[model samples]
Target chain A: MNDTPHIQLKGVKKRFGSKLVLDGVDLTIRRGESVVIIGGSGTGKSVTLKCVLGILRADEGSIHVAGEDVTRASGSKRDAYLRKFGMLFQGGALFDSLSIWENVAFGLIQGRGLPRKQARETAIEKLAMVGLSADIANLSPAELSGGMQKRVGLARAIAANPEILFFDEPTTGLDPIMADVINKLIASTVRDLGVTAVSITHDMVSARRISSRIAMLYKGRIIWDGPTDSIDNSGNPYVDQFIRGSAEGPIRMEVRS
Target chain B: MSANENILSSNWNIFAAIGRVVLAFLAGTGRLAVFAGIAISHIVRPPIYWQLVLHQMLRIGYFSLPVVGLTAFFTGAVLCLQIYIGGNRYGAEAFVPQIVVLGITRELGPVIAGLMMAGRVSAAIAAEIGTMRVTEQIDALTTLATNPFKYLVVPRIVAAVVTLPILVAVADSIGVFGGYIVGTRSLGFNGAVYINNTMNFVTAGDVRSGLIKASVFGFIIALMGCYSGFHSKGGAQGVGAATTQAVVSASILILAANYLMTSFFFSE
Candidate 1:
């Protein structure tokens, strides 16, 4: 394994109009590590992920992936940069107009121009990898349940065999049992693929299960970052408040503002 | 601090307000023009989704024909009756066939069909693309290495530009037939004479001009639709707002462009 970090962000700042969403977020992750970013609602967690992916550019920062600067990359450079990433969107974000297998095979056929037949076969294989059966291949995304949709989304993410994977609130809005199922699948996928994984979620149970290392984002900065086992004994008030799911302490919930 | 200075300041405020409004309008026009330029450029570029373009043609062009035809037919019939009513005072009722055919072929066919297609197709594009935008499907497309402008935008634009002229051609025939029906049946005119006058007076110049207007109107409709939807935010209300704006802007631009084109084509 290379000792250098696979991804690095330095002094990233992002603002939406007058509101400063990400003040100055800096984080780094080595190759083949699953880093889950835990944060409260409206804490700019998704924005951080988006900035890293170049979906939303940072106002001030430097982001490097595999030693290549991609802060303002566009055109073919951006496309090539994106080819290394596979994202499972918070809402699955599956193309509603396409069928299940077609949704899974979308990046392949549309982006890579692979033959539909070959793409469908790989799509089904990916679906099976995510514990989905072959029967649901013909069904539309809307026909599937929320959990099933997320599984399909995961299948799509891994279909291309990307070196990096991003999960935006992967287990959000799922029952505990189903969430656990997804969490286990994600853990195994990251382990087996040996790919770097970055996820954002408020679900501590999920964050704890899926990540080897955990980073807590507060006010657009990583406030607490450590190995998953040490999260409880981190001795930080914010970390304690967040992990315990408490509304008290130094962490204040903005209610009725 | 002084009375004269206060009055001057208040007057300056009005001037500033006017300047701000004008500047905003100019900025908006510039942005829309740039978006349209990019969409046009994308049309001639590689990686054009020909399949999606054909699909959009069916949706925007073929699906919109019935409404366009129905509106044109009624517009032509009404124009004939109105012209007959007005021409009766001047003893020019015999000119109804020539006037109706010319009006339908040159103005009402393209304008009415353009407006109808704007309402039907522009709103649909805005709603569909707006939903995709709000749902992060557009971002997903980016992550998947697909260009949203090419996949979601260019197809609708190409389909609209290519199909609207064909639609207007068909609508022109239907509108003339409508005038013929009302003229021969309702206005007590001889069928053979009405057909003869209509055929003789309607030149290729008139029909070609209208088809040209239809193509221009098509570009406006798709541009407004794609532009509004591409920038849509704030979820359901945003999508709703975009759909409304697409239809309104497309309709207004169609009419405005019709005036400009008409002046250019017939100012002589």
Candidate 2:
């Protein structure tokens, strides 16, 4: 894997009407590095990821994916750029109408236009990588448990063996054991595939386990960025309050009745 | 303190609110237009998902047939009975076959089937996608380099457009048969005469027009469901609202479009 940054964002800003979701965000992900973004709920962690993916166009600034300017790339060019990244959604986002193997092979069959039989075989292979049995490939996503669904989602994300992987709260709804398992799987998969990974999570343990570097997002800006081992002693107040899960901190939840 | 003045003021306020709502709706519709254009562009490009399209065709089109069929059958029967009663008083009982054929083939079958599908398919699409949106599945698709429009919306629209016409065709045939069954069995008409008269009075134009309407209605239903669900906000409440809006909007559009198409096809 190359040592240069695979994904880079500079001065990216996104606003929804009067409320700014991502305000002048800047970040960089080195090739084959796992960077987990940590933030409170509604702190623009997801927005940051979206900006990078070009799902939500930045109001201002630049996004470079694999050294190509993506902020302004539209249509096929953006789509071509997108093929290099894999994302695991928070809820797995499996098509309920499709079986497990079909869901896993969605990118392979639909996005890549592979033959059904070949796609099914590839889907089963990916599923096996996520520790799922081939027997479960015929089942609908609705038939699976939450953890299984996440595994299927993981299988789907890596099906294409993308250069960059994005995980949006992958461990959110899973049990502690499942979350840890996912974290380990993510860690090992990143290592094995040598793919650049970016994840956003409120779970500090997950962030620590899956990430080589951690970034704390606050007020739509990344307040601190450092290696996983240096997070505890980052000496940044916002990072300190967030990692400790303190109610009294620079971050306050918005409450309305 | 006058009643007329109070009523006038209330009406004025209502109109003003309605004006504001109309403007907002137009603005939102404009945004949807742009989104739809983006979605369409994705449809023609590479990375087409034929399997997803087939899957959606089965889900949105094939699964919806029974309800559309049942609704059309009942509607045709009732229309025939009402026409029979009215024609009997006027000594115009011979008109029963003609009116029933026209009613089912030109208006009833497509509109009724479309409305039923709007209720069933639109709500299903909205609820499924809205839930996914609230839970961040859509976002996940984005990260996976999967265009949600291509992966989610395009297949649905295509399936609906393709399947709705077939369903409407089946419903139209079944509905006319229903009127025939009722006209002959209950209204004491000669079975052969009813069938022959129905056939002779009904032109290919009527059936074709109904199927055309069905195609348009299908697109409208799927589009509304997808648009509402894709843009759904809030959480559970937002998703619920999206589902309700999708069904209601699709149904109303089907009716409105039916009237417009009817006038266009048959107006003097």
Candidate 3:
């Protein structure tokens, strides 16, 4: 892994009208490092990811990928820059109108303009990497089970062999066994591809399994960031409360009638 | 405050909520315009999604042919019946073919077909994309280094703009044929005269104008659907609302734009 960071964000601030989502956030992920962000719902973890992807523009801040300032980049330069990253959305986000292989090859065929036959072969290979069979590639996403869908999503994410990968709540809706399987797949794939990964998840087990380092987000800022081994001993009360899944801690759930 | 004052305050609150909705809607429109501009800039750039565009054209345009064809045909038939009844009162029954041909070619065919497409295609686009939004698929698209506008919006818009005129042209011709069928079979008119009158009286400009309207309406319909869908919120309720709003907004805009185009084309 390179000593230089692959993805970096500094003084990143974003707000939706009066509601501040990410407040002057700053973070960095080293090349080939797998970092998982842990946070409660609506704590701006997803917002942070969106800001980095340029899906939601930051109100103020700088986002850099591979040392290039992406904050002001536009058109083809930005698009070309984006080709380095891959993402697995929380819901798998597969197009229902497309078959599994087609979804996997969507970027390869559409974004990269690879021929259909070549893209399909590449898609099948990626699907196989994610433990999905070639037969499954012909089916629609709606036909797959939740776990299978996530696997297909993973396949799609890695289709182009991007240098950076982002997984948002990868294990949110899966059963424990399925979540563990996904976690292991993510870990092995990250290692095999030597790709830098940034993931956001509420599942402590998932965070523990897939990350080289973990960051806990609270009140729109990262309260704790360190190696995965140091997470349990970080002595941060917020991290403690979150990892323990305790109700009676520094984090309070909002209750409404 | 009295009871009447309380009622007035509640009404004011409603207005305030409405104002918020309006502001949000305007903001969404601005964002969509920006998104569209960005997508257009991406069109000629590398990493183009030609396959996706082709697939979308097949889906949005080719798949829409049957519906557009049927709508134009029925509209033409009904128009003929109405003109025949109205013209007969003044002993102008012979004018039915010309009137039907002109109306279908100049106004009714494109507008009505556009409205139908707005309801079908716009709602479908909105629902499909709105569901994707609620599910975080659009964000995923971004992470995949895929421009959602190119992957989602551009193709639909391109397909609609390219195909709707063709559909309108087909509808226009089929509609005129429908009038012929009705004028000859049901209305007891001279078939040859009706066909000749339709061919002669309906100038090429009228047909061209309707096709132009179709192209514009296609853009409006697809854009509204994509814009609403891309900005949907509140999960399922939001998706439903986006779909409804897309259809309604597309329909209204089609009519309004049609009036503007008509005035532009035929103004003295």
Each prediction's RMSD over C-alphas, in Å, is 2.0, 3.6, 3.0
List model 1 lDDT by residue over B1-268, tens digit each. Answer: 6999999999999999999999989998999989988887888888899999999999988888788889888888999999999999999999999999889888899999998998898999999999998989999999998988899999999899999999999999989888888998999999999999999888999999999999999899998999999889898999999999999999999888999999999999
- List ranges where model 3 is wrong by over 4 Å: B1-29, B39-54
lDDT per residue (tens digit) for residues B109-179 in model 2: 89889989999999999998898888777776665556788888888888888888899899988898888
DockQ of 2: 0.53
Residue-wise lDDT of candidate 2 within A95-166, one digit each (tens)?
Answer: 776799988887886577689899999999999898999999899998999999999988998998898888
Q: Identify the superior model by DockQ, candidate 2 or candidate 3.
A: 3
Order the numbered candidates by lDDT, best leading. 1, 3, 2
lDDT by residue for model 3 over B1-268, one digit each (tens)? Answer: 5999999999999999999999988987788779678756666565555666677778777888888888888899999999888988999988898899889989988998899899999999999999999988787677665678777888888778887898888888889988889889999989888888888898888889999999999899888999889889978999999999999989999999999999999997
Quote the lDDT for B31 in model 2: 78
Is 1 or 2 the stronger prediction by DockQ?
Answer: 1
What is the C-alpha DockQ of each candidate? 0.84, 0.53, 0.67
What are the models' TM-scores? Answer: 0.96, 0.89, 0.90
Candidate topping TM-score: 1
- lDDT: worst 10-residue window of model 2 chain A: A1-10
lDDT of each model, Cα atoms only? 0.92, 0.87, 0.88
Candidate 2: which pairs clash? none
Q: What is the TM-score of chain A in candidate 2?
A: 0.97
